[model samples]
Target: MTLPGLLSATVAEAIELVGDVRAVRRTLETLVDLGLGYLTLGEDTPALSGGEAQRLKLAGQMGRTQRDAVFVFDEPSVGLHPLDVRTLVHVLDRLVDNGATVLVIEHDLDLIANADWVIDMGPGGGAAGGRLVARGTPEQIAADDDSLTGGHLRRHLGG
Candidate 1:
């Protein structure tokens, strides 16, 4: 198990006290939220994937008390498992809940479905598309017959 997962599994209820156990556990929870529970704490930074490193940076930002901050991520789910992507979505949700504006340029169906709003710009990528092909909640996007993204979303949503 990763250090954060191990620490969380052995919280104050099962572990001996050192100092500020709550703080330690809170930090571990943050790590888990960023999907770092699946990665070893002692792991080398160079060994981390783009997505993992982005999540690490995101976790650092979570410590700030700043509200109304804009957090933009470009394909942060690049190398994550779907389960880890779910965890990352939850972390993003928390940022939104805390009054942060979260914008994710993602292609993951799960992430798209969870978004409050989505603006899909493509009949095709670069040189072929720039006009908005679809814009709305995932449901609306899925219902759009002209959208390639909508077609995939329909299947992803099992509709």
Candidate 2:
């Protein structure tokens, strides 16, 4: 069992520290769902990869009761396998369903495909890439002619 999972399972009743046991368990489940089931609470923070840290930060937000808030993520899919991307998207979707506005700066086609609205920037990278190249639903962006992102997105969707 994961360190957090073990703690929640074995010493939950004794902890009685803050929040309800159910809330703590829910948080643990969210961590496991984000592909962090193998992590131990005592694990060294510096040992985690960038993607693991990002997902761990996201896990902290999953159980919050906040609504109508805006959450921003930058390349949250960095180290995720293709299969794991779906879980990340699901978590983002849950945030939206709970009335949060999620703005993800992501290059992952699968994650972008799940978005309700997309704003694609970058006619080029570096000093040449700050312009808004496209803004619309995934299908609309895929169909746009002037957007470079559109061209790639079209192929990504098998269009």
Candidate 3:
């Protein structure tokens, strides 16, 4: 759906459609209360902060009836602060817990750290980089010689 259309739905309607209305409202209100900022609903498509967009997308997915489908998400953590990153991770974990296979392409080390398995593509960034240089748990990947993500995660994990 269009961004504006997504935004135009009342907080209640949006919540009800995906997951649970009551639960979603509680979640959204908590974010707003925490000063994440206002969510403006516009005529065509509402303007959304990057974090807001990501959260909405996730919520929609959570509400879906489809099962056993591979869900590929590109940089799903794009606009969140560290705390929100944790929240996003929890949401994703819930999806995995519910039996969904999630493939996420992201640079955020924290989110990457939570993956059941990670496929890190690089040695470099372009044509030379599309190759898979690493694949494993966050711990295993952190020890891989060819993984750039390994170093970043190692530092983050204090290894």
Task: Report residue 134 deviation for candidate 3 (angstroms).
Answer: 1.2
Number of the candidate with higher lDDT, 1 or 2: 1
TM-score winner, 1 or 3: 1
lDDT of 2 by residue, 83-134 (tens): 7799888888889999899999888999988999999888889998999998
**Candidate 2 to truth, TM:** 0.80
Superposed model 1: Cα runs more than 4 Å off: 1-24
lDDT of 1: 0.80
- lDDT, residue 66, candidate 3: 41
lDDT value, residue 91 of candidate 3: 68
Higher-scoring candidate on TM-score, 1 or 2: 2
* Model 1 clash tally, residue pairs: 0
lDDT of 1 by residue, 1-159 (tens): 445665444222323332457866666667777767756544678988877788878877887864979988989999888898888888888899888998899899999999999999989988998989989999999999999999999999999
After superposing candidate 3, which stretches have Cα over 4 Å from the reference?
Answer: 1-38, 43-46, 49-54, 64-66
